[model samples]
Target chain A: MTEARDHVVPRRLIEKPAGGARLRNLGQYLFLAPALVFMLLTMVYPVLSNLRMSVYDVNVATFLSNSAPFVGLDNYVKVVSDPAFQNAFRLSVYFTIGSLVFQFTIGFALALLFNRSFPGNGLLRALMLLGWMLPTVVSASIFRWMFDGGNGIINFLFESLGLLDAPRHWLIEPNTALIGTIVANIWVGIPFNMILLLPGLQSIPDSLYEAASIDGATPWQSFRRVTLPLMRPVALSVLLLGFIYTFKVFDIVYVMTRGGPVNATTVLPIYVYQLAFNFFRFGDGAAAAVLLLLPLSIVAVGYLWLSQHEESSS
Target chain B: MNASRSNRRPGWGWTVLSTIIVIGYLFPVYWMAATSLKTNAAVYASPPQIVPWPPIFKAYVDAVINNPLALRSILNSAIVGTGTMLLTLVLASPAAYALARLNLRGATLFMLLLLITQLLPAIIIATPLFVLFSRIELVNSYPALILADTTFTLPFAVIVLRPFFLTVPTELEAAAKIDGCNQFSAFWRVILPLVQPGLITVAVFAFLMGWGEFLFAITLTTNETIQPATAALNKFIGQYGTQWNNLMALSTTVALPIIIVFASLQRYIVGGLTAGSVKQ
Candidate 1:
């Protein structure tokens, strides 16, 4: 990837003939034109428009007319001051960190498990992707059924094992609702993390582990020394990617609990959605949405840098 | 397969443990399928029917026949999915080819733009898009939904397809050019055909996204008549709160197309996923 990126410019300069080079450049731009135009209109324009909307007093009337009184960070202030913002912010952190810690650990465990060859290894790995491949709505809804209070299978299992005194409604109780969504998100995420980590694990040379074992290292010690250290870059990439995906989650939480049992699962994306669509507070919503971008941008930059570093280092 | 490191055949113990783990992990998917096949009595049975002993198609029948809403939403989803797939392919292929084969100025900038576009939350894009579409009277329309779906798909398609194009040696295009083919024909005729798998992978994923997309479908379209399957399924859950059998049936139906595609093309799709994200 780095080789392709680094040498593209000079190769192009040499490849193009002097005559009609400008016209060829223009023609090449034509190939990119449609996608560029569509992206500009849809993605780039929306982001800029969202930024403009964030600072303006974009009420329903002003939003429709495309003319808003410039409130100049009032929207941001209003959103930040709201108690819901704080709760949502806290929940977002809890949800993201909680989801990441479990998803990575469990996923890494699965990756390690599958990293060892066994009969049906490839098939099992592929099958594990079922959860990840299903639409988030479907996953959330299935979880919703399983977490039901009265007849939910989760409750049934809990009661059968005597884990709970009673069958608690997981998604209904405020205390457990966020956990419920987090569990569902974890399930949705595990397969992805496992898949990402598998390649990292595979990239490790087997001779290192063999040498470690020959040096009287136990299997556990060899894993801790050889595998974990070697897997660091890929693990970081997986966690960063997982954080980005988990942080902006909306559909799963919305579908599972509608971000409630009294604001339990109301993460930042849900908060933004509620502000923008349900309450028609577009400006405030845009402000909150823009705020969500800050951490993501930092992480995205980190991710890009890390990926490039991995490429060059490898 | 690195497990046979010492030249020892993998023990069946590993297979047994792995099988048990896979089964436990996939139990939810099994439950979804099982619940979909169960009769209402079986659905409500205490301790729940792990397997539909006497499986019935009543829920499937009910979801499809008794509920016009389910069928209509599916049809709407199909339209959106197909439209998004076509639009993404039409736009993405050329763009990917350009990025791969041509050294246009600001190529790095464009690549950066594509990456940043993907990182923006759907909510962020949805907020502005809703307002903009409303101004242009495009809300509550298929085009609106399809276009919104494309925001994610287009970037993904280009990213995935560009790798495929890169692997196709520039010599192929050069050879075609030497044979009197122009740049457009060389790309249209030679390069496009070579990346068929990538195109299919991108198309399948784009379609899946369109079919399963919830946020834009819900936020951009208020009319029940125009909403896609994911949004309609959410509404179904709300309207028919504990009708687990029907909900699972609807969910299963909505999920079947994607599952089928994934199963058949697991290799390419998996490869495409790693290529799109990790780029290593």
Candidate 2:
């Protein structure tokens, strides 16, 4: 099932060497300066600026003038009070959780299936990555068309299969619009999950599985007892990374519904985009963005700690 | 383990089942391509013409030849993609090399920063960047979009390339230094050529990121003249909500380059991905 050489490039490249004191050259700081400066201007400054904008009263008129007065917590208060904010907050939860559950399960299933020896395993796996490789806009557009109410293929299939008496417009109804976006996201995400999980699956020793079988364990029993426990670390990383990716989804929802049919699909990112760009409520948007970033920041910190832990322990 | 695994051949049943699964999963891709080829009427038909019986170029014609914005958006994407790729390499390679070899005191901390930056939501950065760009009158310009795109790509490029740099034995650089090459020249003359494959991989990844970028392009550049294919496709979907054929055609056009690149560079790209994620 696996390639003769699973890695096409340097095996030595990825293996982290133990921390050792090496030649220290301050001139190397010159090498680092350009990227450091660029990141400071781009990443560090923008994040801090976002924080600043959230606290200040930044409207369109004041945004450029650099004269917005400090209004600590007011923007956050208003953003929280807005009915739309609450709605988007709830939807964001549903969207993120909904996407994570389905994509992870389907992806894991595919990974396990592909782990066993079979013909064309490599080709099929590569083909599966098509969904992940394509740009989000492309995937979202295809879904938008396929989910069209009147003449969409999904409606045609549902009616033929006797699942529906008539075509249900997937994206039009507020109730189902979030589901539509989640479905598309699952397609986009499944490939990624499968790819990551496969390497982890490969890393588990077959001798452990053989021992389980020798002990009269059934395949299901072996999976639960041995595979599941072994897969925990990889699964943790996959889910955390997937959570962050799905939580900040912008292109799929934006292209599919644009938080449409009465704000039905407005996730946090969409909400932030609308508040700032559409409504010209920069301060409130910044506040809302900070709210969105809050959980992600926690998750990011957890992921960092987890990776560092994995590194040191291993 | 290899011999035993290879000897225990799975039945043809497994092959058939997996093939079915692949086809089912890839149905959306097929549908997109098929719809793009169908006539406008065929697109709206109830059964949705599982096969575009007699393919037509009408949608492609309409999408590209008729709608001038399609070509313009594609051109904008190229410029941005190229610009971002070049900038990312120039900035990221040296930094990545430094981290890999220089053993700077703060290298570990800087790497942590890069990883977190890669994970930061684009909207978070876009909000401040939009305000900042408008203030500086950099909004609605190619430089603005390219610069914004780098916020995502620079960290990514650096992360991906550092491993490649580490693979290059430091003795190579030491030998170059012995030959009277300064540190910079030694790195430039000796180490970089060895990591050309990694450089190519990062360039492709960065270009694709730039080409497909949406939020920054849309938020920063309200000018129709400067919008990339992604924003243009979105605009098309909104304006021509009923034009499924044309929409699919445009979507296919936007996605074609990505497909080509992926096809050609599958090995290196896949290797780079696993190295970044799994090895971490």
| Best-performing candidate as measured by TM-score | 1
* Model 1 C-alpha lDDT per residue in residues B1-280, reported as the tens digit of each score: 2344523776577788888988998888889889999888888899787879778999999876678878888899999999999999999999999998787898888888888888888999998999999989999999999999999999899999998999998888777665556677778888899999999889888988898899999999999888889998999999988989889999999999889988998887787777787772
Q: Which residue pairs collide, candidate 2?
A: none
* Residue-wise C-alpha lDDT for candidate 1, range A1-314, written one tens digit per residue: 22333423333344575655786788799999999999999999999999999999998778898788999989999988999999999999999999999999999999998888777888888888888889889999999999999778999898889898888989999999999999999999998999889888889888888788778888889888889999998899889989899899999999999999888889999999999998998999999999889889999999999988877987
Docking class of 1: medium
TM-score of each: 0.95, 0.94
TM-score for chain B considered on its own, for each of the candidates: 0.95, 0.94
lDDT of 2 by residue, A266-289 (tens): 999999999999988899999999
- Candidate 2 accuracy as TM-score: 0.94
Look at candidate 2 and tell me the lDDT of residue B34: 92
User: Least lDDT summed over 10 consecutive residues: which range in candidate 1 chain B?
Assistant: B1-10
What DockQ do you compute for every candidate structure? 0.53, 0.47
lDDT of 2 at A24: 28
